[model samples]
Target: MQLTTFFFVCITNASSTQFWPGFKILLVTVVVLLAVKNYKFLVLVSHALFLMIP
Candidate 1:
């Protein structure tokens, strides 16, 4: 699940012309949250990634 979130953020960042750095921060945040079993954070990031993607 964490890996999925990381990939989602990475892809979203790669696709965008700007706001990619924010994705990096989001990726890191997701990783930390995954370590702590914060599934809510994962869900939030996933939705954010979905919104960012085309």
Candidate 2:
């Protein structure tokens, strides 16, 4: 499930030509922290809203 969320988030940006490098870096950092912190529930739901980020 986490992998799915991560994949979607990354793929969403993958097609963009003007994506900001720092934004992607920050998102990866945040996702890692969320995973490390054991916030599974949040990580699950966040993806729904994450899809709307752009």
Q: Which model scores highest in lDDT?
A: 1
Instruction: Compose the digit string of candidate 2's lDDT tens values, residues 1-54.
Output: 766566555646643546677876676666566657666735653664466466
Residue 22 lDDT, candidate 1, scale 0-100: 79
Candidate 1 residue-wise lDDT, 1-54, digit = tens: 666666666656555756558766766575556646766765765676566657
C-alpha lDDT of all candidate models, in order:
0.62, 0.59
Error of 2 at 50 (Å): 18
Badly placed stretches (over 4 Å) of model 1 are 1-36
C-alpha positional error of residue 8 in candidate 2 after TM-score superposition, expressed in Å: 4.8
TM-score versus the correct structure, for each prediction = 0.37, 0.40
